[model samples]
Target: MKRREAIKNLMLFTGGTILFSAGLLAGCNSPAGRTFISKQDIYFLDEIGETIIPTTARCGGAKAAKIGLYMKMMVNKCITNEERLIFLEGLKKIEDAAIEKYRVEFLSMNSDQKKELFLNIQLEAEKYKKDNKSKPSAPVHYFQLLKDLIVKGYFTSEIGATEARRYEAIPTRYIGCINYKKGDRVWATS
Candidate 1:
């Protein structure tokens, strides 16, 4: 019957359309050319964080908290595709700058040299902000993101919670007034 043929054709067309659409959607979930950072890059991130907050006599730096892994995880999970590209670019820029100026990779540079390189990048970012006409809503520098992640990862880490600041697991009483010193480790639990 003509009616039966039309119904069968309609069902087949609908099923094909659904399958095609589903396949397209699945392909779109992954960003095009999304960079996959390796262990070496992770080490670079750790060294970068370490340069920013090097190990002092009292406490350990970002490397102690494994800030590089934190940064990589956050980048892969939290940021958009565009942001990921920007991050990768900024990372390469840092490495390029370091190699050009210090004759070494950022991770291989000494703390002082690393500091100078970061300062240079900061200056360049400032110059970019001043020169650019439009104020875009996305991140302009990777160093800022790196620093933020380092701080967040470090503070939330066991070393930061236990060594850097006093961790009060159980609070018997809340001190309303406390004497302040010129230099003191603030209560992290507070």
Candidate 2:
């Protein structure tokens, strides 16, 4: 190769390498690289999920279904950045509310206390929605978001589908008419 051509190619290669290296270094410091969900946060979420779907004699609950981890994944990947921020802030708010109301942390509260707390929060969310006249397109209250995530994660989990609800791997025969019972668990799939 000609000397001039060789120098030009070397410059191009060096420039490309420098750009790639800078990008890699920048990524290490990016917001995405930080750990937003700590272990404590995950445990808190698990407790919240368990409260939402307590384990019954017949089936496992949200914690057993790993609903907290599912919520984390969904919040990180599926939701918008604003929604994620709201959810993270809501966690702290829940703790604060618990402390103010019961003089104890949310995780330290008993099942009945937790249920009452959740019910109160649900009422507050409803009142907020009603007062604000929020449109359907607008974002919902963080508690609503959390409740939705918990329910979605739990019902979609393997334990929920198979144990909490009736699960039939294959329907051997289709019965058009079947007896209905008032307290029957709904079928997850037909």
Candidate 3:
């Protein structure tokens, strides 16, 4: 090929490649048929997390740690598309189940009712997990995913580390062997 023709061909190919990549990126950013995580959804997830890890006299629970936002971030970024669908669907199912059972939305229900609903859903998730155990490619139970996210987010948050668990901001020395106590809280650093 002539030198001028070769340079022109290379430039054309590079331009086309850049345009294709830009198009793909733009398509990804466009939320076509995508279900957005609304403020209500965040509140719902917060309620679920609070039910899973209720506030106690010692410290604040998952809700105080803002676990709903954490779950949303993880679902959007860390999980696969299929898992995200399942998680969102599970939220709807929980809402539906509440309405079916009590004729009331989950947020309106009392704490005891919330706890009961969570237990029932947890049982259902366990059953589903058992039924799908034989399938090698089966997805994880949505409740399990929710639970994991809540625990992880809560424990790692500042409130959880300092209030729920004993946190040492600066340790002078390591205790290789410490005396054991029954009701002592675990160290966050440990």
Which parts of model 2 are misplaced by more than 4 Å?
A: 1-35, 134-137, 173-176
lDDT of 1 by residue, 29-141 (tens): 44543364557688888888888877789899889888889888888778766666678777887888989998987777888898888888878777776766376764556
Tens-place lDDT per residue, model 2, 60-85, is 99999988789878886898766776
List per-prediction Cα lDDT, in the order shown: 0.78, 0.84, 0.84
What is candidate 3's CA lDDT for residue 188?
93
TM-scores for all candidates: the values are: 0.74, 0.77, 0.78
For model 2 the local lDDT of residue 169 reads 83
Which run of 10 residues does model 3 get worst, by summed lDDT?
A: 29-38
Model 1 has a clash total of 0
Error of 1 at 114 (Å): 0.7
lDDT string for model 3 (115-159, tens) is 898889889889998999899799988888788888889999998
Candidate order (TM-score)? 3, 2, 1
Candidate 2, pairs of clashing residues:
none
Model 1 ranges with Cα > 4 A deviation: 1-34, 129-138
What value of lDDT does candidate 2 attain over all alpha carbons? 0.84
- Residues forming the 10-long window of minimal summed lDDT in candidate 1: 29-38
